[model samples]
Target: MRTDDSGALDLSDGDPILAVETLLLTRDGRPGGWRRAIHRADDFKYVFASNR
Candidate 1:
């Protein structure tokens, strides 16, 4: 989750600003890597999915 320049979580009438960092693992339970991601939302779907 993230906040605006004023440090406020204004989710209405504002830009979607959320930064997420996640770790990845290999199929054999090994450390694959990690990545930083950002998402933009302008709809009300009430669901979030990542197809990476």
Candidate 2:
């Protein structure tokens, strides 16, 4: 999860990683089916997870 000014996105703080643990998330322990993985903003549709 590393990027620079040449990043594909139009935004960057010279940082490589935006959010960590991009593979899993858990707001509670009931929705075992509400966790997912992807690189983007919070969709709240499937719960985008992160980790780095």
Candidate 3:
């Protein structure tokens, strides 16, 4: 998944919605991976990977 801005939200899944939602709330959010960016603070990369 990808977003146009830092505050944008993106989602990806290879499983059921219920399972995805559970992972989103439990794993991704807790580890700051769900709504977080991967590049450096100054980098303008647009790619976002969230299993949740």
TM-score per candidate: 0.39, 0.22, 0.14
Q: Mind giving the per-residue lDDT tens digits that candidate 1 earns over 1-52?
A: 4345324543654667556688899999898999875555443336678999
Q: How would you encode candidate 3's per-residue C-alpha lDDT over 1-52 as one tens digit per residue? A: 2344323323333221211222245454564335433332333434779999
Per-residue lDDT for 49 in model 1?
Answer: 89
User: Model 1: what TM-score?
Assistant: 0.39
Report lDDT (CA) for all predictions: 0.61, 0.42, 0.35
Top candidate when judged by lDDT against the true structure: 1
Q: Compared with the true structure, what per-residue lDDT tens digits does model 2 show for residues 1-52?
A: 4454226544455433334333343576443344322244432334567896
Candidate 1, number of clashes: 0
Candidate 2: pairs in clash: 20-50, 20-51, 20-52, 21-50, 21-51, 21-52, 22-49, 22-50, 22-51
Error of 1 at 40 (Å): 5.3
Each prediction's RMSD over C-alphas, in Å, is 6.8, 10.5, 13.1
What stretches of model 3 exceed 4 Å from their correct place? 1-43
